[model samples]
Target: MSNVGQHLLSGGLSGFASTICLQPLDLLKTRLQQGDGSSGPRFASPTFTCVTIASTSARNLTVFRTARDIVAIQGPRGLWRGTNATLVRNVPGIALYMTALTHARSVMAVSPYFKAVQKYPSGDSRTRQGSVLPTLTMQGNLLSGATTRVAVGFILNPFSVLKARFESSIYAYESLSGGFMSIVRAGPSELFRGFLASSLRDAPYAGLFVVFYEGLKIETYWTSHTTSAGIHSFSAASAGALATIFTHPFDVIKTKVQVRSEARYHGLYKTIRTIMTQRGIAGFFDGVSLRLSRKVFSSAIGWAVYEGMLMLMASA
Candidate 1:
């Protein structure tokens, strides 16, 4: 396969894997973020540190309690409350990823590094080889992922507001009427919602995601030369786990900011400060276990399926 193709394969796989495996934990997190139960940020965010969820009867893992809580209040369908939003988020994220990666790979093909190697005194022998090209190409991939993620975020901010609101509160789920209008009426500055945070979070995480995925495949190629889907799965899981940690603070702020009508949190900085000073450092990582665990499963399965789908598409 072509190197560009390989990058795409990895990207698709990562996308699918992240979704399926991480979704359950993600469900719980959304419920927590929306304040579906009890008081405190635990309702708004669901910290692992919450003693209430622990002290409650009929619970083992927070996953189980999260499920019970949802079913009791909202019924079985509630389990998937924000699922469409999640899927919606992924589609654009992937579309942007594909476009960016393709462009990046193409630009770097004839870049200076490859040109230097081509004109080098030691070797014209490898003139048309892909090995030297990928080194230069990966840099392009990083740039492309970052740029496209930013561009994609603009198209997607309204949807993000939708997701946050829907997941955070039943009121949002009850009415999908506003659509983009909600965002438009949100005022010029607020339209982007958590965009800057999302952009910053997505770019580097996506870049490293590519790097780690490619590196895993290379590492496997060195030993057994297997093409297990696990490499893509694991890479995505790892990347998602890491991204969650860096981005959770912003994630919290976004939800609060998007849903607030009175501007209790003001801007991103103020929102963060409010959360920290009022709730402490642990508040920032609310629902971390659920998020991390979800990343492992969702990234693994979603990415594996998505990559397989792409290969199927390409061959067809």
Candidate 2:
């Protein structure tokens, strides 16, 4: 296959594998972030924290309880409720993002302004051990990852909306097409709901992920004097954890804007205010554990599979 074709196939495979394995976590994260959809004054009062504490003591939606509830209500298959929408959104999304990143990095590698800093006399541009793509400066990595990710996120925002709503109990979207048509009828506003939050989350997350992943790989290679898929996976997972934590608030806001129809969630600023007022600081971290778990595993699997495939294809 051509290089671009190889990247497309590798990315699609990686996305599919990760999505299938971790769909349950994604669903759980959405459900937790969606909350009970009650934005009453009682939830915003100073005593609200005590009420929350008491409520949780009574019937908290812990991860295990959420999983159990889904299974009880819809069976085991319910855990993967949004798999179809996720696959449709992610397969092409990953493929395009990977391809764009590769092309961007390749272009940047050749540019005098963004070229990697040389450590040896030969001034080679090859990546360090365990990396297949051309090495560029950290700035290049950040720029390429952030720009490509946000652009792709924009293109797929509608599918993202569908996926979030599908995963939530709040929306009973019987089919992917039906859900999409509903959004279309709601106009561009609905189609692009949560896009700002998504961009905010994705840009930093993708950029920092690449920066951290590459830095870790280099450090690991230096320490261990070796490189392998295991090293790549470890690096990717570590990077994913760090980036997920830093960008999780936007994730919470994005989920709420997409999944809920209340007036409080109709706009980005309103959603942020609502979450802060009703749920306080802890609210932004809702489902963070689930998202963190999902991101770590997904990054590990997706990056390992993608890079490994490219290395194999290059050799072949």
- Candidate whose TM-score is highest: 2
Off by over 4 Å in 2: 36-59, 118-129, 225-227
Q: Which ranges of candidate 1 are over 4 A from the true structure? A: 1-23, 34-64, 113-141, 310-316
TM-score, structure 1 vs. true: 0.71
Clashes of each: 19, 0
Q: Which 10 consecutive positions of candidate 1 have the poorest summed lDDT? A: 44-53
lDDT of candidate 2 at residue 181, scale 0 to 100: 92
Task: List model 2 lDDT by residue over 1-316, tens digit each.
Answer: 8889999999999999999999999999987887633533212123111122112311157889889978997899999999999999999999999999999899989998778865222333333345677777889888988999999999999999989988877666678898799888878998998999999999999999998988887777556644568778989999999999999999999998887666778888999898888778888899999999999999999998998888888878
Q: Per-residue lDDT tens digits of candidate 1, residues 150-183?
A: 6777787877777666565433334455544655
**lDDT for each of the candidates?**
0.56, 0.83
**Global Cα lDDT for candidate 2:** 0.83
Per-candidate TM equals 0.71, 0.90
